[model samples]
Target chain A: MIPPRFHGVALAAGSAAGAVALAILGLWCAGFAPLAVITTWCAGAFGNGTRIALSLQEAGPLLLTGLATALAFRCGVLNVGGEGQFLAGAALFTAAALVLPVVGFALPLALGLGAAAGAAWAAIAAGLARWRGVPVVLSTILLNIIAVAVLGALVEGPLRDPATTAPQSALVADVFHLPVLVAGTRLHLGIVLAFVLAGVVWLVHERTSLGFEAKVIGLNPAAALRVGMPVAARQMQLLVASGAIAGLAGAAQVAGVTHFLSAATTSYGYAGIVVALLGRLHPVGIAAAALFMGLLDTGGRACEKQLGVPHELGDVVKGVMVLGVLIAAAWAARRSAAAHQGPADG
Target chain B: MAELVSGVAQSALTAAVPLLLAGTGELVAERAGVLNIGLEGLILAGCIGGFAGAVLGGTAGGLWLGVGGAVVAGMLVAGIFAVAVVYARVDQIVAGMAVNLLAFGAAGTIWHALQDAGRDSLPSGAGFDRIALGGPIVFDQYGLGWLALALVAVTGWMLAKTRAGLVLRALGEAPEACAVAGIDVLRWRFAAVLACGALAGLAGAYLSIMRTHSFAPDMSGGLGFLVLALVIFGRWRIGGLVVGCLGFGLIDAVQQQLQGAGAAGAVSYRLFQALPYLAALFALAVFRGRGNGPAQLGRPWPEER
Candidate 1:
């Protein structure tokens, strides 16, 4: 019999194999050179310094957003408000950037405010779930639409950049931007912050009582409540924390990458959910998955130039990969369960 | 003033039909214990299918063919979702989101490919004739509009009065009990999802063939999500759903009218766009416990050994 420890590994391996096979098939069907697609994907994702830099830049936001989703998922909460929270964070940070005087600490303060704003946004859903019988999933999706609307209003009216005709916010002063970690590339300090947060999440998951309680509530709220855990509170806390993390991702994108707020600033929030699931909701695994997905995002853009494939095809790959992994993991669980029961039946 | 009022009323009816049709379908699925949130993807696929069918089949009978293609596409997509949710025991939210992402990309790819083939403009075709009940402005409406109301009435009757309705209700509330009573929970749930998909597809077909008479990528534009909200606003009841859809549709009509008239000023059209979603949240928050959905709304039925 396979040990319980190796079970997760088996599932991961199966999902990866299936995802790759499907991706190849999709490329072939789309009339692209399958082998060339992979090579170009690799080249555009990480072959050169510029590509590597772009991947890291992409990974920075994804890391935080992925962790945000994974943390909530681990606690049995399907918090789909990461996108909304991310936008809230970016919007808040931008608001601060416009108001606060440019100082060394202003960037950090804006980021902190962004996280708080995200938490506040998420708290609306948490509050509804707690007080009303409204489901978090429904509320979160609703909140995402509302957030998008809010963004549109801000950019088109209050935040419109006078110099540009498009609906975008005014760029913050260069002093408000994050310091470059690597010269000649776009790598910034936010990437370091992302890794630090990942470590913090890992420690909390492994060593903290709060984490234990959250996990317990996730597994079975009734049992957790019977065992004296604050099921409701923990659920709220985890959702808020998830929102805070996503907010940080949004803050990073604005301050480190875009230097302005717009509709597209928080696009990675949905992709981050896919990353969290792909990483099996583990902190380290989520980090790895974020980077891998980051590579794909960069590579997808490259396909436009190299193979004339639409960059949105990358989105298809991401969706298919997630689906493939989920199906494969389910298959593995069923197979293992069947195998385990064979001897008993005999 | 009379003309404006009729125009608004006509627009409201046109807008509400799609939401009503989709919401009613979702109501059935929810009654059968499956929450199929991939309605957005199914609708989009239907749009593409309906558009393609109409263009290729020609206008004489192309509209109906387009709708048929949409149903097939929606079912095919929803079938994938059903297998994943019912048989493989996948997370409903994840599966739904994944399906949406796939639909978004797939539809875009097809749209772009069509553009490459020199069909860049919106495909021109015959739309449903507007039948005037009272006057041209007051009651002139697409046949699809009438068809949607008929579907709502039919769904309402089927769910409330039929024996199959009782079984579906029982299955949703207590799957184990229904299983003990010899009902195949999986089959019923699968069938419910397909029905939901077919209805959502019809809504999509109506959008492309009747309302716009053209196809645009991502044209559904969260209409699926709006329908999901309407289902909740309706409290999962068909009668309430009709009211909810009509109310939201009126709001949408007014928003568009105001935008067209350029009266929004500082509020911005985007704020008006946010109104429907905000209204949904407000409705859900205020009307929390008035109408309860099925007990096991999203729980996957465990396999019987």
Candidate 2:
């Protein structure tokens, strides 16, 4: 009994370690990766200075996406198209930056406006799900295609950077870029905001009556309605919140990291699904998962540089671990359910 | 306009061929009460496996071999999914997702290995030769085109006419009721989902080999998702499903046309590409998930107690 309790507290950690072990098994399957290289991949991710910063910096946006997915999913919304919503958010940010003339100390205004636009764009699909009973998964994914097309249309047409002769949007003014936190550190203000948001999500879910409502709706829609909750309104609000968080994630990616928009380079939105799932849909868990994934991502690139294992190898490892973790969760859930069957009524 | 219209029709036919195959397979699978969500990943895995086989073996008949290889590869991948969700009694949706993630990673590993090995004797792509019907309208399509239409007709007939189809439909419509009737519901349902996986794989092969010559990693894009949506929009009707395929094809084609017509930077272009999904939404709006979706779409049937 004592051992099981010990294991219970360590359950999430132990399973995560097991997932890593499974990933090692997957790598070994190829018979191409050498042991020294794997060691180097891990070391390079955490041992050095700049590398760690890049990992944390990258995780900032991913954490937001992860949190967005977790919130929506916890509310019983399956948002598979966060990638598209993210791209649309970037597009919205770009559109806003271009339309609004940058004035002195107008930096905050620009970023805030961009985020609202991003939220509005995502709310379109959320609205569809609310009004029409369209599955969030289907609508979001479809919107993803539309997002790509819109970005494609813009880059190829009016938003085309004529002077540079590349299909990049007009770079947002330097004044609009968020201030870096520590001069030598890659820690930007965005990372801080992500932490704050994570706290806010936790508080909203734990403290407020709204949290109970969201949980009820997610757990059972019919039950929520019978309980006199405005299921539709809650869903709309949750959808918008989910999209806005995802939008900020994409906006942060653009304003924080790339500083330029491209349909091809980034996909933090979809990657967030993996993060959220890995984190088990808990806000703090998402933060940790995003950072871990960000470490793996950084490690993957390092492996490409140091060991010739290719960046895709890291992606392979990620995909494998995700499956491993999910399968374990499924079995665990099933077992728990079976265990609680009241001893078969004696 | 007529010339453009004809061209759009032809393009839509070409685009819709694989979707018709995959969507029909998914239709059958869902009709038996399982969502089979790993379809996108299944198609990718099938493409990679089929591509690997065709490329590794310098066979003269690449298309036939590729199609066969895809079916086997697809069924094998999907078989793993069936075991996890069915026999293991895991959540079908999550199992489908697990299969997808595994397929995606597996396909990536294969692509990297093949590319690292150089083109070598691995046969360069030129599969699926077209049968030119001389004059114009109905005949000069590729082998897959004719096969797609044929498969649609056959599936439609089988679904409406056959005893096996009735058993499958019974499992779909009411698993408990069918099990009470002593039907081997689990086995039949497994067979249906496996069929869906194989057909979807064939469609993936069509994309890499027939549509485009070179096979890129994760080449199915989200066509599988679109086909899944089509299952809804089609209201599970075979004919309507095929029409839905055509409709999606046209939407895609029109989006490209608009890009050609200089709507490139416009947000409307994004909305344009969303046309099919919106159409799917419109469908759910009109039908409201009542008579629209399958009766027992995501549940797995149990064996006799």
Candidate 3:
């Protein structure tokens, strides 16, 4: 077997090469962007503390979103409705925020209880997948559509700020806002909480029976069933948990960063897919991926504000990197799967 | 009363055109087991390319040029995803989503900065001849509308009555078996996928050149995802694509009709907007049992077993 040191060096070189390739593709045919432009984009993303905090602030919700995606993916459940769940969380949290005078600190309690609310929203779609036997992919996407319309209705009608002439978002009560971690920075306690939860998830997956069952379920549902693991139940729980994490993503974004839910996606849940895949479903890997992507997120905004390179360069990179990484990760996993599985059945 | 029904039918068809083309293409795609989620983005790319082509040429020529542009754009995108997911064996869902993200990101920025700077999507004196068949037989739609209907029939025939169709089914059912049976797995699969991309692109182009007559940022909305859902609901069949589009299109038209039907306030209309997704969910519930899907769907080929 190859030494661990060799594996590290190889992996680093491979990821670097992949990154450079992603940058090139992002600049070239993906759009009519250039290399110096990409350099500027990176600089703007990580240039200073303010920018870095923006990255962190963005990373906070993204981490939760990433965790949700990985959690569902690991359990062999495809929770494509994370986006919808996220919106649901935002709506619920907003409703809580509005009722703060009556609810008091109880609003914060509800805001943090993303798991239950998010689970409920996600369960509706999961029911379609489990009971109805519709593909998770289709049902979740459909759920997203319904969720958007629902959100739009709330934002424009019932939940309208009453302060604005146009479709308006209500300002969240301070009591409902996530406690700040760093003064003068948008960096909220949510980042630390998100990481802690991600850590717990990783431990739960790597060190627990459920994790093994989840992996087995993912590897082969048929085999997993034969092994007496309840595949449907695990998938159901995983999806609900995924929804909760995704809901937390939305809640954190609104409470910590935006201080309100906007009509459009603040891009929390969607960006999580890239982080989850790039991290290869590992907790630490997710943090690193999120930071790297957080830089891109910041940088994309920078390019738009400064170089006039258009924020899309970052988007192109995000897409290429995620898609390319998925391909690479899949290939690597496939190569290792043979060796990894040999001991199991044998 | 009759006019109301006919008018709703016409508007529904208009909305269904792009969905028809994109859904038809997705039908070809998922049959081979690749769930392309980036359709929203792919259609956006087509909208951009199609608009550019239409602007460059005059009338009929520009229209056909737009089709060519869309096909090329489709190929360019479908080619990348196939390489990543098929060759590199990436997670198809995320890979496809990434493509969509990239496509969506670029279209607005590129159109405004690069293309519009050169007057790209702007109408350039040339466009389509609005066909006046002048009767209940076929009065409302332009020639492209008629062509879209023809495409549905043709694609259905190709899927059912052809050697290529058989190979696609065999590959979908069992790629390894198809390979063992001496079918060129990559070639047939790639052909199906690229065709999906091209048709999706054509659908996107149709939005700009035929129906709305211009390119707009992210104009396809979530229709790409809707079409994909319809594909699953339709069981990845060509006939299903047409029927699904009509069904969805009717929902959309009816949602708007709810305005005339005087169905409550703005809030209720928002709920009504959710009709397509809710319809799909209900349809899935009614179907209740899973059909035998493509045997090799979502299992990357030469994949680790």
Candidate 4:
């Protein structure tokens, strides 16, 4: 039998293989050759410096959002409002950047405020869950619609770029732009920060007492409460922290890539949940999963351009992968339970 | 003022049809213990499926074909969700979310493929004609609207009076007890999910064919989630569901009218558009702790050998 420590690694590898196989099968059903799709996907995702840079660029927001989801899931809080939190951060960041004087420190200050705005937005759901007995899952989903509406209103009114007919905000000054890590490529320092933040998250989650308390709450809330842990307070804190991380992702997207707020931004928050689940809610795993999803995004576009495949193929693959993980995890849990209880229980 | 009032009322009925259909379906599923969060995706799949089928048939009869395709598409997607949640014992919420993503991607890909294949424009007059019910304009509606109302009545009766309804409700509250009594809890739950998918699919078809006359990506929006909230707001009863749906529908209809009345500059139309969602959120907050949800809701039932 395989050792318990390697179970995570084994599951990851197994699910990854299953995902690839399933994607190939799906492509074949759509009339594409399996071998050609595989080659094309690989080459498109890692073909050149520019391609890799684009993939990493896409991975940045995903990494932050995935980290947000991971932290929340670890604490047993289903914070599905990552999308709303991301939008809140982007909206606040844009408003702050448009008004604040162009300075080196202004960028960080605006990002901080954006994160705070996300935290505040998330606190509303937390408050509702704590006091009013509303489910965070449902409330956050509703809040996402409201957040979108708010963003739409802002862009068309206060944030409207007067110079253009388009319904989007004015671009932030170049001083607020994230510095390029590669001189000739679009790779920005935001990705570097994302990597650093992932490491920090991993350290805190694995080493800190706070993380321990959160995990206990996740595994069994009643047991944690019995142990005198402040369950509600910790859940509220983790949820806010989760929102802040997702908000940072939105803020980074504004300063690093888009430079303005618009209604047509990518659904990074929703995609991040897929990443977190695929990564098994572990920090390092989330980082890798983020990159994998980034590759799918880039490669899917490449297939669309080169072949006739749709770019949405990436979403299909990601969805299937997460489902595969869920099934595998459940099976593993049952198997281990049976093993622990010996043959008689089975 | 009478014309305006009737116009708003007519629009409210139109808006409420899709919600009522999907809400009724979700109510049954929730009562049977499966909270299918993938309702949005199922609706989206139905939109594309119905649109494609209608386009293929290219006649009045295509409307029926479109609806059939929608029901089939919705059930197909929900089938995956059912397998994962009911058979594989996956977490219902996570499985539902995955199903949503899968449906979203599949529908989008199919739409793009259709566009590429030169099926770009939607067929004109692809919807059912309004039938007069012997009153004002408010009494006239598409055949589906009347059918939706009938569905609510039938479902309410089925839940209240039928042995099948009792078994279904029992499956939600105490599956273990049902299992002890030799009931196939898994099979019943699976069927409940499929039924929800079919109804949600019908709702989607109503949106595309009867209401909007065209399909757009993610057109179902958060209507599925709103149905979930409304189901709760109604206190898990048919009467409550109808009242909640009509209330939200009136708010939506008024919001649209206000937007069309050139209130854009004075008050942003986005705020009006957000009213239904905000109202639902407020209702949820106010009606908290008054839920009559099934006891086994969202909990996966592990089948014993």
lDDT of 3 at A67: 90
Between prediction 1 and prediction 4, the one with superior TM-score is 4
What tens digits encode model 2's per-residue C-alpha lDDT throughout B1-305?
77777767777777788889899999888888888878888788778777776675555766667777778878888887777666666556655655766677677767877888884233644445556677654345677778878988999999989998888788778888888888877888889889988888888777766676568775777777778888887888898898888887777777667767877554545556656656665665676565666677876555212
Highest lDDT scorer: 4
Native contacts conserved, per model:
0.68, 0.39, 0.80, 0.79
Alpha carbon lDDT of each predicted model? 0.83, 0.74, 0.76, 0.87
Relative to the unseen true structure, what is the C-alpha lDDT of residue B289 in candidate 3, on a scale of 0 to 100? Answer: 49
- Interface RMSD list for the candidates: 1.4, 3.2, 2.0, 1.2
Q: Could you tell me which residue pairs clash in candidate 2?
A: A153-B264, A153-B265, A154-B264, A154-B265
Report the C-alpha lDDT of model 4 over A1-346, residue by residue, as the tens digit: 7799778767766777787788779779879998888778778888988889989999999999999988888888988889999999999998999999987699899999888888988898999888888888888888988998899889888899999878899989987788887666667899999999999998888899998999999988999999999999999999999999999889989988888888785889899899899889999889989998899888877887888788876778878888888888888888888877889653
Question: Against the correct fold, how does model 3 do in TM-score?
Answer: 0.91
For model 2, state the Cα shift of residue A89 in Å. 2.1
Q: Write candidate 1's Cα lDDT for B164-240 as tens digits.
A: 88887887799999889898889998999999888888888888767887788768877888888778777788888
Best by DockQ: 4
lDDT of 1 by residue, A1-346 (tens): 7688766655655665566567667779978888998898889999998889988988999999999998988988888889999999999998889889978888889989999989999999999998986788878888888898899888988888889978889998887788888778778999999999999999999899988887888778889999999888888999999999998888778888888987654468888888888888888888888898888788877977888777666767777777877888777777777887886683
Ranking by TM-score: 4, 1, 3, 2
Ranking by DockQ: 4, 1, 3, 2
Would candidate 2 be rated incorrect, acceptable, medium or high by CAPRI criteria?
acceptable
Query: Candidate 2: DockQ?
Result: 0.45
DockQ of 1: 0.70
Q: Is candidate 1 or 3 superior in lDDT?
A: 1
